[model samples]
Target: MNLSTSNQPQDSSIHILHDKESSHQELGSPSEDTDQQYHHDWKYALKHYFPHYTYQPIGTVQIEERPSWFYCVAYGIQHVLAMFSGVIVLPLILGYDSNTSLFFSGVSTLIFFIVTGGRVPSYLGCSGSFVSIILTISNYTSTSNSEMNTNTAAVQGAILVLSLAYAVVALVVIVFGCKWLEFFMPPIVTGSIITSIGLHLSFLSYDEATKSSFDTYMAIATASAIMLISVYAPTNALRRIALLLGTMTGYFIHAMCNLKGVGPSIDYSEIASNPWIRAPSVYFNLKFDSSSIGMVMPILIVLLAENLGHMKAIGSITHRPMLRYVGRAYLGDAMGCFVASLTGAVPFTTYAENIGVLSVTQVFSPLVILFAAVFAMLLGFFAKFSAIVKSIPQGVLGGVTIILYTLIAITGIRIWVVNKVDFNDTRNIFVGGLPVILATVMQTPLQVNNFQLDGIGAATFGSIILYQVLQGYDGLAMYRKSIKSAFNKNKPRETV
Candidate 1:
């Protein structure tokens, strides 16, 4: 009777199982088949965009390798162009002087590339999640300035110190025994975060979608056209740099318009004077004050938690065998913050824009990134190149950014697709989004002393707690009432 009906196939299955130990039984169902296919799609996308990380045997035979000189000069400049727009935006939004912000952004990017597994095929740029946090700090600092000589350095010190603390906690959690954390970070949550990032960026993208005069939407159209080509078209390695190519295309479109108005103004005297081989004068004699350091703990914790999940999501994208990328990324992130604080640089993190680039281009070599990073640092010091980069019409940058953000949104969708989740469950819908929505819409509605959480986080946890408690009572009460009703209905013997 114990004998099962299952029969092992003899030799009919010719498909070789390359995974060896791993089988369809690993997850207890054939459904993982879909998951595996989705994973394949994702890996293909990651390799295409980040060719520096993933090896393409076919590519070796098709294209000839150039001497290191031409590689460093030509391809390096392209790499710089790819990540340059991303590197400078952090300071712009953080309320720093243009020169200082630009310097720190550029320097921080260089440090990231040089340090964080230069073979990871990614760049460091401003993280959008940090935008809200930066703005929050600015508001607090500005509001508190009149009451006291509010120290920006001290605030940054707190962020750096607290951020490191958070990273350590995450690092420990990942290393020790939090593999269970994987369950909650399913595609739904990942997609929401990615969507949130793109949703936010749309405000800026719309600005770039039109011409400088605001009379024509040609630039935006050109940017969009290029994005479609990059995302959908079949082309070789050179054509894969769509965003870079798109921006150039938009510039030509703008130039044809021949408007007299300039976009953002440029300055190059310092870039001209900056030496190429000199030690970077970073980590300025900056010191943080002790006051208000405690206030930043929540943000740090939030980012730490968010980043943990983000690593898994990125892991799903790259076919890199381990979470080494995440570990190296955090190490770089913490180091970047430390350097940023010391050098008067803006607080920075891994840029999601570059992540989206991976989704678009199947290339993933670390060497290509190493080339890109060094060139960026050189460009940071080179004033002349900086001027031309800066002179790129705002509309052009905006148009490309619109596309940059779109890829980000798509990456989120891809994550969701790969994760087989039960969206049919109403509880899931409520659990995943309700809290964030509530937190964002209603800030500090309920205050128990100074412990006031915003709408989403509060509403989220509150509703669940409330529902669980109420559901328990309601179940017990209904059970008791039902028992009484049953007794009354079955009392036929006594009544007779």
Candidate 2:
């Protein structure tokens, strides 16, 4: 009995009794360390900011060596199909040429994607959200500044200056504010703002899915199918491509149905007659007045907020930290918007349509999305190509857009939840409900100050103004001040 008591094991502090170094070798691999660092620096922030979700990196093309054109093309089509419906509409609504913007926007998107190192898998196109932003400012300046002779060029010039300024400030979100993004965008204000964005934008896709530029029901039916399938399907590559593939399929179905000829009319005549390669005009002239900056700055803030939400969403979807990737996206998005505004395309944003694409496909390669951007550019210059794509019946495109837009709305809700927003609070309730409801109302053809604030009517009240008023009276002002302190203790306090 005494001899048996000596056989007990003891905890090892340093030296192991057996050949345990092999176990350390197995567990302490360099790849594992790199992965852990990646997760901590980026992925951890993603979990802190976005919805609870997962992606398995579907459809990524290998970049260890140059990828083949076939791989690029296949990936590009999927990207294009995912993004096109929402992208092309920016031109259609704002009375610009869709083909022209698409061709160039496409090109700009690709270049930026490549420049950003293909870390995000999404395409760029004309952003419809800016239709209201541009037309609002243009119409405002046109009517009020009539004595000053401000043209669309002047309107665009003002926007360009605003975007450049925004880009500089946005960088501060990283240089200073990303970790405490909630300070300025406290869950309540951000959640409300996002909800307002979603509620306001809901009808955009619905309008596309439900009606045609020319009246037709079949087209809408086709579009709706695309939207619904993309939204409801299980997350996988096939689901990611759902709306895209469905839209193409709908186009085919429409073509077959129209064998005898009946759908909204499309005229390719202008495209056919267009020049092969004309350089777009740059640095349009300005006729800025004091009031115009006041009008534009609010919309710019809303847009920047929308874009910030998107980066957060993508980070959640990819399980990657936006801290590492979002600055580039903001840079690209602002640059893209500026480029678009210069060319008479409405400003653009990162679309929620790609959320479906990610859920369905599971692949997240920035390169694949960029390829689509390059293809979009080529399409932009080719009038015939633009005309052909634009010719898809409004109803069919609408059908696709309705679901995509709704999903976008849902995405906003998802973001709100991830941020742990307390919806029960009255501040959340007031700012949340009113603007969105009013925005939906004002998004129609409305006029104030001879200014067409259009989609932004919700953010207003009295001479105080739209959601812009929130910064002055709502919790956002307090949060922003706190953020400034957190960012710079020495920063002089400024009232909203």
Candidate 3:
């Protein structure tokens, strides 16, 4: 239908036009009646922009739409299960309370939703990128959880500083746009970063799973179950819940073995003794030391690469243009991490695991993620629930994580494949390989001024700088031309 305006007060007639003919028409400057109509239209758009009520589900629900309340809750629970291990494991490893991690994850995800205007479909979880550096700076031996807590303040301080650094990077992206970031983190560099993250964490998977022969066997069973369910499930619905179902299957087996006194058994005493409700304490976990800053700030590179990759992946999946939201996504994630730091939680980033879930379900509803956030928040209030999460045997988590982390690495490779990055070009090879190697090298006990430059951070910085240096002015010009051509090709056409 057409929106039309005319000056005549009494004689002006309303006309209903066909869809092809209907167009907004302005006869003259808006009269009193026209002004009221315009105001109404404006209000309608604004109200719909941030919808509160559930919307009917489409073929594959859009980010702004929702399924039924029950469906939303079910999808939300699926997302929670998808990201649960990654969200809680970091804190468990670092000796921080898992309850705090769950609370902040929910809160940060809500913050991300508000900041992105509910456009980006992602779940904020504790970051794995920070693990190596936290281990180095805190001198953590992983021998005693108490010893890790003793250094929690120092690690938190580093994260706080890194969050500020991320904020700065976000500001730059906001001002300069994704093109600025693209200059350094071209597809090749980004792909390598993704691959390196998986490779870096691979060792942990082996260690955690192989603690004993039984644990190793259980890990294999868990991973295999997840793969099988996701790939060969009988129904689409079953595939969507594959991660949750697989994890539960593995857990059941572990529990069964425990009953027979064969494998590691979960201690139920912790859950039984824990209270039903407790507020998360906000400790001043800040300790400003220059050395810590040197170590932690470099992680900003890893976070940036990861956040950018997430935006790109979601954009591709939803078939929506995400160029406009890149800066806000970065800033939102940074703000989430900053808040988490203040509350004695680990650094937060958009969870790749949840994105994998979205890819499988093809459900892009923000409400589903919002529901997950609410559930997570509720879980945080229950100390016993947090204990139950912690009670999942390490072997099971490792099995699942092996799959999750491997998928993360494959995602990077997929980016390269999708973008058709030219491996034939020697420069592309150097651009991708050098940083990853350097980062791997940094994994050792390498230090400068008592500050350890870990693999992820070192690789991130090394890739950016090395790529720029190696590519030089001539290479940059060609890259810019390519980007300009692609942008022009994708530019929308105006309708008459």
lDDT of 1 by residue, 86-202 (tens): 565333334443334445555665666554435344555555544434444445321101121123555577667866775685454434323323332334554555544455545
How well is each residue in 19-104 modelled by candidate 3, as lDDT tens digits? Answer: 21223353444355666765655555445444453476657776656888898899888887777656765676666677777888
lDDT of each: 0.48, 0.54, 0.73
- Candidate 2: residue 134 Cα off by (Å): 3.2
Where in model 2 is the C-alpha error above 4 Å? Answer: 1-73, 110-122, 135-151, 179-181, 201-216, 228-238, 241-294, 397-401, 444-452, 455-457, 460-485, 488-496
> Which runs of model 1 end up more than 4 angstroms from their true locations?
1-79, 89-121, 139-155, 174-186, 204-240, 255-318, 324-328, 353-363, 388-400, 435-496
**Candidate 1 displacement at residue 404 in angstroms:** 3.6
TM-score of 1: 0.60
Q: Write the per-residue lDDT of candidate 2 for residues 1-496, one digit (tens) a residue.
A: 2211435222121123122444546677565565555444344433323221223233442221224556556767677766665665445444455555666567567645643445555556544345455655556321100122234665666667777876776566545545454444444444554555556666655655444443346556565566566568665556666766676777776666577577644444555775766543233455665455555656655555666776666666655544444555666677776775566555655666665565555455555566677776666565555445555555565555555555545665676678876668555566566655666666664556645455553453311232235455654666666666657844322110
Model 3 whole-model lDDT (C-alpha atoms): 0.73
Full-model lDDT, candidate 1: 0.48
TM-score, every prediction = 0.60, 0.67, 0.82
* Runs of candidate 3 exceeding 4 Å displacement: 1-54, 141-150, 240-243, 438-442, 476-496
Cα-based RMSD of the predictions, in order? 14.7, 11.9, 7.1
Instruction: Order candidates by TM-score, high to low.
Output: 3, 2, 1
